[model samples]
Target: MIYLDNAATTWPKPNQVTEAVAKSMKYYGANPGRSGHKMAIRTSEKVYECRELVADFFGLSNPANVVFTQNSTMALNFAIHGILKAGDHAICTVMDHNSVLRPLFAKSPDVDVSYLGADSEGVIDPSELEALIRPNTRLVAMTHVSNVCGTVTPVEDIAKVCRQHGILFLLDASQSAGIIDIDMQQMKIDLLAAPGHKALYGPMGTGLLCINTDFELAPIMQGGTGSYSKELTQPLELPDRLESGTLNLPGICGLAEGIRYINRIGIANIREHEAKLTAYLLDGLSRIKDINIIGKKNTLGRTGVVSFTHNSKDCVDISSYLSSNFSIATRSMYHCAYKAHEALGTSDGGTVRVSLGVFNTLSEIKILLYALKNMM
Candidate 1:
């Protein structure tokens, strides 16, 4: 089957990722850091190894600042809810997923949320963010990349604005984590969240939230962190403060290998390949008589994800046609990013999304184009 829904989750994870997870479960699946046994110690080491890799990959100076979570949604929730509180104000863009939007929405009337608008191309001006900063503004939540439109937000510039305003910067790097170059320290990002399953090519049920040491937020959940066990209250440590319960040791083991794989291949090479594929997709889709590409009409400053809708055609019908007839897999409907669809006027049924992965070849693009053409 042709898989084009990688924006949802990457398929066919790297061999190293699978091997590492299996090895962890087989050799040292004991509850990490919960016991002094050799197996538990080994599990603890393996989990820490992943933390170190994630810290290094994102340019975090310390691994302790990284906390493990179930997925980007959980990480995002921790950041948005942990930081914004009563009488405080936060800012986010319309392009953000419900992960950011819903949490902030719950805080409405108490914690003010000012939304910055994105254009038809799904680009938000960095300067506009400064205007949204109110005196009570405590944080600026931004998506590193738009999941629906694949529009890359200008985070560095936005970070600069947040810095100038003394507001904490929260970045949802769900779509660009392993695929994009992000220096958390250099970018002045206060809280960064991402899923290891997507571009990282790790197994599902793994995510990371890297918090800058200088920044502090209350724990969202309370439970055992395998540290300060004798104490009744949760530890006020960097990771233990946020991460409660047992770590996903096997998943973290695989995630470490996934980061290693990305490093070995180099992000630049991976991005270049995706760029070519995105360009091909855009140009070809443009030529189709009844097709209308979403967001930027070109590949400039976007990820490999391309969302398009047929003129006067329902996206679900198109997706079903492709899947049943050509064995193609595409994401239809809101893509879990309603604000982006509402901004682009695709809110009814949204657009058919094709997200290319590192393993996707030019031939796959040709087949997808052929299938799309036949739909008309």
Candidate 2:
């Protein structure tokens, strides 16, 4: 099957990723950091190695500042709920996934939130963010890339505004973790959250949240963290403060291996390969008269994700046809970003999303184009 839904969750992870997961479970399945046994220490080392790998990939200074979570949603929740308090104002763009939006909205009614609007292409202007920064705005949450439109937001520019205003900058890097070049130091990002399954090519149930040392947040969950056992309360440490219970050691091991694969291939090289496929798909889709491509026409302001709408065809119908008849897998519906669809004027009928991964080939893209052309 030609899988094109990497935006939702990547498929066919690298051989090393799968191998690493299997090896971890087979060799060292002990709960990491819970025991002094050799296997437990080895397992714990695997988890720490992943944290260090992720930290280096994102240019984080300290691996300890990185906390493991269930997924990007949980990471976002920890950041949103832990950082913003009642009566505090927060800023977020319409292009954010529900993971980022729902947690902020779930806050007490006393907490105020400003839903910043994005342009038709799902790009929010830095000046607009600058205008929305109130005296009480404690945090500015934004996605590194729009899952629906595939448009890359000006995160660094927005980060600059947040720095100037002394507001905490929270970046949802669910779409840009391994695919894009992100330097936390250069971006001045206070908190960055990402999923291991997507760009990192790790097993599911793995994620990372990198918190800057200067920024302090309350713990979202409290329990035995394998640290500060003498204290009745949760420790005021970086990762232990946020992470509780047994960690996903197997997944973390795979994530560390996946990151090593990325480092070997080089992010720039992977991005260029995916961009070539994206451009190829875009050119092919543009040739179809009935197709209306969404997001930036050029690859300059976007990732490998491409969304399009077809005339006289429902998105679900086309998606089903691609899956059943052509053996092509794609994503339809709101993609968990209902507000983003509404912003792009695709709320009535969500566009078909075709996202490329590092392993996706040009031949697969051609086959997809052939199927799309036949549909017309």
Top-scoring candidate (lDDT): 1
Residue-level lDDT for 267 in candidate 2: 91
What is the model-wide C-alpha lDDT for candidate 1?
0.90
Per-residue lDDT of candidate 2, residues 128-157 (tens digit): 887788899999999999998789988899
In model 2, what are the clashing residue pairs, if there are any? none
Q: lDDT tens string, model 1, 1-376?
A: 9999999999879999999999988997899888999999888888888899999999998999999999999998888888878999999999999899999999888998999999998998898887788899998998988998889998999988888888999999999998889999898898999998999999899998999747677778999888898999889877889888888888899999999999999999999999999999899999998898899888788899889988778999999999999999999989778988989888877899999899898999999999988776
TM-scores for every candidate against the unseen true structure: 0.98, 0.98
How many backbone clashes can be found in candidate 2? 0
Least accurate stretch of 10 residues (summed lDDT) in model 2?
211-220
True-structure lDDT of candidate 2: 0.89
lDDT of 1 at 239: 86
